[model samples]
Target chain A: MHTLREIEERARAAADKPAPYGSDLDLAAYIDEAPERSYVDSLEQLEELGEEELARAGVVKSGRQRSGSFVQIDGSVVHRKALEKGLEILSTREALEKYDWLWGYYWKAVAVDSDKYTAAVEMGPYEGYFMRALPGSRTIYPLQACLYIREPRFVQRVHNIIIAEEGSELHIITGCASEHRIQAGLHLGVSEFYVKKGARITFTMVHNWAEGMDVRPRSGIVVEEGGLFMSNYVVMEPVRSLQLYPTARLVGEGATARFHAILVAQPGSEMDVGSRVILSAPRCSAEIVSRAITKGGYIAARGHIRGEVGGVRAHLECRGLILDERGVIHAVPELEGRAEDVDMSHEAAVGKIAQEEVEYLMARGLSEEEAVSTIVRGFLNVKIEGLPPLLEREMRRMMELSEEKAL
Target chain B: MDTMRLGLGGGDLEEAREDKETVLRVEDLHVEVEGRRILHGVNLEIKCGETHVLFGPNGSGKTTLLMAVMGFPRYRVTRGRIFLGEEDITGLPPHERARRGIGIMFQRPPTVRGVSLAQIVALCSRDGVDVEGLAADLNLGDFLSRDVNHGFSGGEIKRSELLQLLAQDPRVVLLDEPESGVDMENLQLVGRAIRKLLQKDLRRRRTRCGLIITHTGYILDYVEADVGHVLCDGAIVCSGNPREQLEGIRRYGFEECARCTR
Candidate 1:
């Protein structure tokens, strides 16, 4: 019953959310000064601050890189090749910050009172931003970016890029959240993981947006030899609709990929999630795990882990826990093994909290609801132990953002 | 004279007013589960400050009787009434019964993950119980910050369950096989924890009453048992000295007691 700004003024503090640490990046104060990442017309006359400067300058190199060939089940080989082209997105800070939410899939807000648009936050270019990892120095520390769009606008678009040198390891975490109820928004973001041989990249994202928030994040990872890629995504929002699929192509020998996710949809939210892995090299391994929870809510999880090249083994596991009767969950884990010698398997489970389990705690004097809350918290906690203290704090901080309860 | 009708018409019987000290009294309790009959008219009573043992074979309605007493929904009492200090509680919900100062220690206990033991102990307390002091009593001073029961060993579970029951401050405590899967040392820990629950005076309050449902008599040796009943075939077929029944059954079996049935 309030305007977007007024509502944002009254909502619970982000501190109640789960992340273990707060970032120094002040969204309200970041100046639009020079564009974060934009192209220069003269490439030959630019001076840079080492690799960081090159990355910030949007100059990266990729060519004639042959990692190895992975033999498929049909005896065909997937030859590892260089990513032929480069992609860039440049925008002013205000233009990018206008759509703050990272996974806002849907929203609708017009001056906070002109009740005409019931738009859902859609991930696209408006919420879009660009970054070029400096050209030469291999990036070791990953960058963290976040978008928080309130109800005044439910639509958004985002584009991001990362370029790795011959040898570097980078980790990134991105998030999306809404500011107003029923804010219709959109998110369409592209992440180009241009990895040179022997570089490692890990991208982890956690979303706890409202039920109306919808998200679709697309990623492309081209891995060279001895490189690695990992994805950790934990989403606990029912109303915020979502569709995220990260693609990885292992181009180098010993290239590896792993994706782990936990989805919890409480009453009144809907989510559709998916992931895919393409192995084109021998000795390449990929693992995908999706944990989904639906309580009076809905979750559809689909994943594909394929072994296209010979000597490549991939594993996929998806587990879902539905707390109440009305809650629904659907999970499909697919394994496409092209090589007969490839080792691959997929498993998925969906279930509710056991009655005896509830009675067990009740006999000890705890209420049924309290028991379920504890169980749910513990089940997802297995992933919390692995997150960085700061990211963990941030993840926890976003958990309280669910309009249902105070943190 | 006792079996014959002896009171004025429409007048309540005076017997209910007499044994005011009897904290728990069950008469002719017939319980069923899933349309399958279980307990057949079982009668048992425990006076204040007394530890009563309900012994039985598996599926002997031991756990069923405990669940019914604890007011679990699945177990139905077809006939008879469970009286707690003259109050007829044959049709009360589990939480209602819990509020009325009744608690239990589950046989197959479920862990309370993510919720701190301290927090759980406070929420489950009928008398606003303190978690740390109770944990210390049961030698759980170090695990208070951890989640309830999750990842705990058998002994930790038993001890922690007792810690929770101690916090409840109930007049009658129902234990559903407290010694299952526990080792000898853990069994000792269980016995000690129960002893503390039975004897402690929290902030100067009345001691708790106990109803222990167990197959083994190890708990009996550690905690004093004022009355013992063997439940089998849906009823109490035998009742006598706790030690005598335990030792006698170990050597002579139920067939020996069947010969002397009512």
Candidate 2:
């Protein structure tokens, strides 16, 4: 394992390197410093933060249905608590300072010097959530985390690590948002997830940002034997520019991974989002599904699945809908098979909603506008397999709410 | 059999039928699809409580007539007007026509991905109808959660269409080949569903009207009709007793029927 000095040295060397995808932004334009926020013992003390805004980001202010709650505003960790036993939630900085072994997992799944974003998160002053589920432990409700930017023209850098120990189940709902009045801001986040043998992790994220906000998130996951990792992401509001591509690697036998994303880009917004999975073990499988809709904006929806061993199976589906004449959608799906017996496939489609589909609904007594909205709602609805019923319902409700606001 | 009435004008017919309230009337209706003229001066009228069967060969504009009446943009009504009661509805859109009480069952409907059958059924019902109970009666209770018409068998599609119509409860129903893809076992179920939708059991108090286009005339065995018209080459060539028209077409074929009318 590398020491902290070596990781910082590597990040500094690649601080100027640019990413391969998405438009590059000048990191110097955003302010890295902000006024410190005092820590809150309980989430109820956060009532000063608009409950409506917090709820829009999928955060329950009361924490009634959350197993744990973590809230970080700007560069400070304001609130972090574990309501249930056998679960741990802490600020990443504190966790690193408390546990000496965290260095082994940090920058292990994700390379430190891979791009400028990763390097910036490592070289800059950042605070994120660290969550872990003890071995054989399972929570009835998912843990909640929120990364909020309350300052204007500020850059919020975060690095998160999540682990599900052997025979344990962990579900997380992470929401990233900015203050309503703050228009110009930037968010750069790096997340690493580890699923041990016989473990499962379901991560659902919702993004509600201002019209002038720019976000770039980099995430990676590693799954062991018989483990499963499922992720669902949604972004319905407007952003100036947002880009992310999270990848998962299945390294043990019979492991599985699935990713589902729903994106809506309103006017003046540009989003580039994709998911990639590499299956390297026998009997492993992966699926990546994405649905993107643009209303006078631009979106690039992409998916990649690679099967590296015999008896492995993977599929990728990317579909997009263009709602306005000024809107544009690009779908890119890729499938690769390295072994002779590996099975990998992909399907991609991008266009406007079929007029025949609209007319079909109209025949059932829906007006033209109502029919179009219903079809759009269905297009964005994806039923994720293996998701807990409560999380599924919550995700549906969130999607419906955002859909109403966006459409 | 009623003899074929040739050169009948719309004004004269309206004056002659002043006693009966016409629920649906099409006059001098000419239609085209994709710039190809399909129908030529077709005229028909269905009064309240009346059921009409249309018999024709392939590509004879039977479906086009129904589509034109439904006001689908594709089936352009090049020359004529459609009426529902006293209002002329030729300019209204399909959903407007539907809201005004006209429902149609397509022979091959497009599959709407991610839209469940139950959702569509609920949308069709203006009131809060028991969608699950209605679907169960149609043997489609389990299909409520499935996408609309996606991977549905031929018979399942028919039953699903019938379920939507039942929920809609329209005043005027247009059916295109209700028995085309149904098996022998499901044919009876489909027939009963259609009969119920048209209120056939009501006898004297029936208010629903239907215009059905059939190639095999198999639906006649379940739902009796008041009038039958044979459409040949986009024009109604003959109008007569429903059973006699079926027997005549079965024995002599559509070609002979068109020839005899000429």
Candidate 3:
């Protein structure tokens, strides 16, 4: 129950966290001889998992070190990283946005305790988490995770593991947040998922961070025959800059996936998010909705859907609003089908509040500001309607907070 | 119709403290928009309860005159005095002017897609207003839950604006082309809404003022205008009793005299 070595190990592990190295490591294989699930209740268990996760993650790095690929990310050009099946994640220390040289202090960190996936009463740090899937192993009880950054940091990375048995169904929710006015930080993480035939996977992420934070989170989905993957990303913050592309590949016939993203950028923030689906199977379908609001800054969204198979049906939509004159919004929707029998389509629009419309509200006794806010909130009615109960409340709270800032 | 009154005699409003009305006074008013001149040395005055009609062709600065009074950022008064009673409103923002009892109805109501007509009316009602009765008067009872003018027909926009004016209880209700695109039934409903507004008391009882802007006299047959001014090229080209200018503009049109007066 108590071990000084475990505490020291966990401290050393947390101290030396680096960028995630493995996109392919099976945490399930290490389940044997590994610390018992009960040990997680003890620091010793944590020490072992953290150590094992770090070591296995090194194996992943060796795999990448074999490939002719190197990690290079910076301003303007967004990037992402993920673990296909492992416990190792990249973690970087906080660094200034202009300080690119300090990225080496980061370590890729992943939750190593897969046994706590269904533990109703979670202990220290494992309350919630991001997860990925293995090549052959699948999970039924989706794991929970969270990511939080308080100070300027380098390319911090995280990896997740989610495996569904041949016909298992799972739902996982990941949350990320930081207090307002906290020192600016960076979060660059990724999730790689594998869904077996007849399995269903739904991964939801809600992100709210303080200003000065720039995030580029990338995710990849590999769905087998009769599998399903639905992804929803809801961001409620005035993030300085964000570029994310959560992607899915329909590799087996009758597999389907859907991606939905909603982000509201207040007076001086920028947000960019999209979903890309590639149909590799003969009869797979994908649908995506990308919505952004630029009240004072900018948001650029680019979405693409490629129906490479003859019987695939895919739809992509990108819609956004610019609430102020100085605010900017850009949307790009693309669809490419190699087969004549496939169906694909996309649409986008951006605009400001109309004068006559404002007058109409003014005559009704609402002040110009109130009128504009009402109109804007109304415009998001459709997108908000599509959100789940928990996320919808969070979105509404974020809107109210932004309005308070305006006041 | 023996139905015009002036100023609400009260202690205070949530925004305006004193409700007594001495009407508007404009002297040597000069207004500009987007770095270009519009109103050129215009002077005018209105009695507390006078009904004024502004007549001019499109883009003759008729709308600009009203817009200038509303304090739109686009229009700047280079030299002028605009007073509500003795209070100078020239430097005030649009909302500030509104808080002081000046309300305007646009020719085209602003479209706010998810804001319900009823929700806004309740917001305007300010202090425990009877929204149900107000909706009934403007014939907007059926569309209570519908967003303000999002999918409203032409008639509905006009009448709904009237309902808001009544609920807001502004001392001066400036109607911009109130007769445009109004159907026969809505014309009656809109007129009746104005009539009720002109008579609605903020508390207990008080007379309300009405300023109707138009290029046609159809609104005159419904709401009586005490005086009328011909606004051309940003300045009032001519001024006279509503009975005189309404008929004069109709007979001679604003083209002949509106140019000469400026």
Candidate 4:
């Protein structure tokens, strides 16, 4: 394992390097300092953040149905709690001060020198959430976390760590958003997940950014023997530019991973998002699915699945819909099989809605506009497997709410 | 065969028939699809509490007439007008016509990838209808959550169409081919569903009407038709009892029907 000093040195060396995908943004354009926010004893004490704003980002104001809750505003941690037993929720800074062994997991799954965004998160003063489930413990309700940007022209950097121990199951819902009035801002987030042997984890994220905000998030995951990892991501509101490509590696035999994403780009917005999974052990499997819709902007939806050993299976699917004449959607799905007995495949489709489909709905008493909206709603609804019922309902509600604003 | 000419002229025919009783009237209708004329000067009428059957050979424009009456944009009504109870609906779009008590079932509907059958059924219903009960009656309760027309069997498709029509409860139901691809088992279900939709079980006070296109005339076993028209070259050449016309066509075939003056 590399020392913390060595990691810092590596991050500093790669601070000027650019990522391979997406347009480059100047880091100097955003300020690092903002007005510090005082910590709140409970979420109800948050007077500045409106209930409607929190609800739009899939955060319950009362925290009635969540096992735990975490709230961070700009660079400060406002609220953090763990309501259930066998669960730990704390700020990364606090967790590091409490446990010295956490340094082993830091920057282990994700390279600190991968790109400038990850490097910036390391080199800058940032605060994020750290959640963990004890061995053999299962959460009844998912934990909820909100990372909000409230300052204009400020860059909010965060790094999160999540872990599920052996025979344990954990579910998390993370909502990322900015203030309604803020037009120009930046968000850089780095997340690392570890699923131990015979463990399972499901992470669902909803993004409700402003029209002129730019976001860059880097995430990585590792699954051990007989473990499972599933991720569901949704972004429906407008953002000036957003780019993320999270990867998961199944390193133990019989491990599995699944990733599903729903993305919508409004006018003047640009998004480049993708997911990749690598199967390195025998009998491991992975699946990636994405649905992208462009109203009047540009979107690049991509997926990649690699099988490196025999007896492994993987599949990737990407579907895109262009709703406006000026809108553009590009789907890129890749599959690679390095072993003889490995099975991998990919399918991608990008086009406009069929005229016949529109007419068929019209014959059923729907106006042209109503039919189109219904179809769009159905297109955005992707049924994820093995998701908790509450999380599924919350995701649906968020999608419907955003559909009203975006469509 | 002698030509049985019922003088179907403009304005005079409307005057001759009871205007209140006529549910649908097509006056000298001509239709074009993709810039090619398919129907030329076709005249037909269906009254309240009556069902009409149309028979024609392959590519004889049997489906075109139903599509034109349903107000599909691609059917392209080039000449003449269509009236639903004295109100002209030639320029209205399909959804407007559907809202105005006109519903049609396609021969081969496209499969909608994510729209479920239950959703379409609910959309078609204007009032609170028992969707699950109706689907159960059609033996399609298990298919309610599935995508519309996705990988459905021929019989299942026919039953699904009937289910939608039942929910719609339109005043004039246009069925392109009700018995085209159904099997022995599902044919009875489809035929009975059509009977229920057209209100054929009632011997008196029946207000619903239907216009069905069939090649085999097998639907006659369940629902009785008041009139059967043989469309030859896009024009109705014969009009009489449905069973008699079916027997005549069976004996002489559509070639003889086209050659006959009637």
Q: Give Cα-based local distance difference scores for all models.
A: 0.61, 0.90, 0.60, 0.89
Where model 4 places Cα greater than 4 Å from the true spot, the runs are B1-20
lDDT of 2 by residue, B179-232 (tens): 998899999999999999899998576788999998898999999987788898
Name the regions of candidate 2 deviating beyond 4 angstroms.
B1-19
Candidate 1, position B196, lDDT: 73
Predicted candidate 3 versus true structure: per-residue lDDT over A241-344, tens digit per residue: 77666668889999988887767777767776777899989889888877677767777777889888798988877777776678877887889888788988
Please give the fraction of native interface contacts (Cα pairs under 8 Å between A and B) kept by each candidate.
0.43, 0.72, 0.54, 0.67
**Fnat of candidate 3, please?**
0.54
Range of the 10 consecutive residues with the lowest summed lDDT in candidate 3 chain B:
B1-10
Number of the top DockQ candidate: 2
User: What is the TM-score of each predicted model, taking all chains together?
Assistant: 0.68, 0.96, 0.64, 0.96
For candidate 3, what is the TM-score?
0.64
lDDT of 2 at A205: 93
State the weakest 10-residue window (summed lDDT) of model 3 chain A.
A68-77
Candidate 4, residue B135: the lDDT equals 97
Model 4 global lDDT (CA atoms, 0 to 1): 0.89
What's the lDDT for residue A328 in model 2? 88
Q: After superposition, how far is residue A86 of candidate 3 from its true place, in Å?
A: 26
- Pairs clashing in candidate 2? none
Chain B TM-scores, listed for every candidate in order, come to 0.86, 0.93, 0.85, 0.92
Q: Residue A332: error of model 4 in Å?
A: 0.4
